[model samples]
Target: MAWALLLLGGLFEVGFTTCLRFVDGFRNVPWTIGFLVSVTLSMGLLEVASRSIPMGTAYAVWGGIGALGTVLVGIWWFGEPGTPVRILLILALVACIAGLKLTAGH
Candidate 1:
């Protein structure tokens, strides 16, 4: 349950970041509201999940998920470069994130 919540929180992190791009320096009201809502939910879920998962492990996993998801979003939605090296590094990050989860003992 905690892991699930953590994952959700991480996804919300991605949501907030994606919304930020649409926020247009806080001038866009709808996207700004989305950002606020997402950030609130993300932090709330993280706080709840941290109660069961080790703080360090939880934070790293959360951050890793957010970073990975954001990068994919950038490539797919924002037309960011998807170079071979970038993909390789992303795969490496995925491996590291999985390693952390495997060793978390949760």
Candidate 2:
């Protein structure tokens, strides 16, 4: 349950970023509202999950998910360039996140 909440929080992080991107430096009222809501929800979920998950692992996983999802969305939705090196680095980040999860247990 905690991990699931953490993942949701991370996706909200991506939501926040994506909303922010559409806000034009927060000048757009609706997108700004979306960004604020997403930020609040993401932090709230992270706080809830941190109660059970180790703080370091939870934070790393949350941030990693947000970063990975945001980059992919940028490439797919916004036509951001997905250069070879960028793709490789994103894969490396995925490996690192997986490693963190695998090592989380005693």
Candidate 3:
């Protein structure tokens, strides 16, 4: 359950970060609201995840998933850079996240 919360937190982290790009320097009201809500929820979920997971491992996984998801969304939806090198880096991050999860041992 805590791992699930951690993954949810990672998803929300991606949401808030992606929304930040749409905020237009904090001028877009709707995006701003989404940013705030997503950030709040992400942090809350992280807190819950911390109860059962080591802080270092949990935070690494959280950040790794958020970064990977945000970059993938940017590439797929926003026409951001999708060079092969960049894609490989993203894959590497995913691998690291998976390694952390596999070794976390609940």
Q: TM-score of each candidate?
A: 0.96, 0.93, 0.94
The segments of candidate 1 whose C-alpha lies over 4 angstroms from its true place after superposition are none
Top candidate by lDDT: 1
1 against 3, candidate with superior TM-score: 1
- Steric overlap count per candidate: 0, 0, 0
**Model 3 CA deviation exceeding 4 Å by range:** none
Clashing pairs in 3: none
Q: Residue 12 in model 1: shift from native, Å?
A: 0.5
Least well predicted 10-residue stretch by lDDT in candidate 3: 97-106
lDDT of each: 0.95, 0.94, 0.94
- Scored by Cα lDDT, where does model 1 land? 0.95
- lDDT for each residue of candidate 3 in 1-106, tens digit (9 for 90 to 100): 9999999999999999999988999999999999999999999999899899999899999999899999999999999999999989998998999999999887
lDDT of 2 at 30: 99
